[model samples]
Target: MLDDFMTRATLAGIGVAFAAAPLGSFVVWRRMAYFGDATAHAAILGVALALALELSIFAGAMAVALAMALTVSALSGRGYAMDTLLGVLAHSALAFGLVAVSFLSGIRIDLMAYLFGDILAVSRGDLGVIWSGAALVVGLIGWRWSRLLTSTLSPDMAHAAGINPRHEQLILTLALAITVAVAIKVVGVLLIAAMLIVPAAAARPLARTPEAMALIAAGIGAASALVGLRAAYVLDTPAGPSIVCVAATAFALTGLYSVARKAR
Candidate 1:
């Protein structure tokens, strides 16, 4: 069954959707969209690091993403504006990664694959890694759901309840890094934030509770992945961007629905 590349790709997409669901919901609630982008952009640097050190791409991406997320978390509220800091780091990381990749003269790397993903080419091992990482992310978020939610809704309340908001933020940072590392193969660094944000945003209009939003987002994400892959195959388009396009469409539809509901 897994012998089919398409089957592997489908499973991989679903796995990623599940992982993105809870974390993405938190990201939306916290307004951490740019933070997600910054962490994802840093993955390119991880790619360069992996290539340089002969390490697993996943490991390298995870390391650099974690480092970037941590750096931003640490530097936040320290005189430098959040958006400005992220802007500088995000662009710098991408530029450095691109230049570093160019320096690897002996290696013939398809940088497009890293930037835009090659989901159809996912191997069985890759599928395993995706699923494993997905499971870990899901479990981690599940364990911290209540605390994270408390922190997001009100840091003061969380502190009163003895749940350190900063610790919860760190958990999210760690999870975000893992998601970026695993998602690189599905949507690439350039579009990973779309995968994280679009589905959640799409679900926001339709869901009343946080849990419902996450579930709906997961369903939407899975649908987008499957539909996007099918559309990509049929239209001969790039799979990664195709997936993001589908998610964007969902976002638009949901936004329209929200506006129409408000008018009613």
Candidate 2:
């Protein structure tokens, strides 16, 4: 009946995979992997604020992630290089977050869990949060798929179509924030970027079109979540990192296959 914590954990993992995979494809297409990482790293700071103010961690994380994403979007047009800006923001947020977390007096915190996740510890309430957040991200992506793709292919093309490229970017930013909020429970901040990138990258060689890539990436992500969960159970390893490791391995194999096919 799969009606236990393990079931909840598995469901949470799958939900996150579903939401993150398609968005990951856009991230790969636009080369925004670093931006995703920066927003995720800001989650640590959110955790600190949440604990300090006695708020929900999810809410805090979401707020911080949105703020970070918006800030980047606003600044990206103002003479700042994208990679450099994200690098500065990502490391600074993480450093400040660690410092802030250290100041919470007499409270025992599982820092490792926030960094690497503890999926097995997820509860029914967490499952609700995960699925809800995932649904929002997926729905938003599906609703704006065409415009988003247009903007991604070329901002001028999007403008000519009367679609505001900036608006599409904001939609992606919103989706990224929600994904980060939900994913923290399943994969933690350290591995969220991996979840957002690896599956999409792995699916690249096998996919002939953008839509095909997104679908295949989602499938790969879901399979990795399930398979990695089982591997962690048997091997007694960290579930979040184990999943990322499996995804990386899959990416490498696909890359090799592509190379082999081209050589033939």
* Alpha-carbon local distance difference test for all models: 0.94, 0.93
Residue 179 of model 2, lDDT score:
94
lDDT per residue as tens, model 2, 1-264? 346877877888899989998899999999999999999999999999999999999999999989999999889868888889999999999999999999999788999999999899998888889989988998999999999999999999999999999999999999999999999988999999999999999999999998999999988888898889999999999999988888998999999999999999
Q: Which predicted model would earn the best lDDT? A: 1
Clashes counted in candidate 2 amount to: 0
Top TM-score prediction, candidate number: 1
Q: Which runs of model 2 end up more than 4 angstroms from their true locations?
A: none
TM-score against native, each model: 0.98, 0.97
TM-score of 1: 0.98
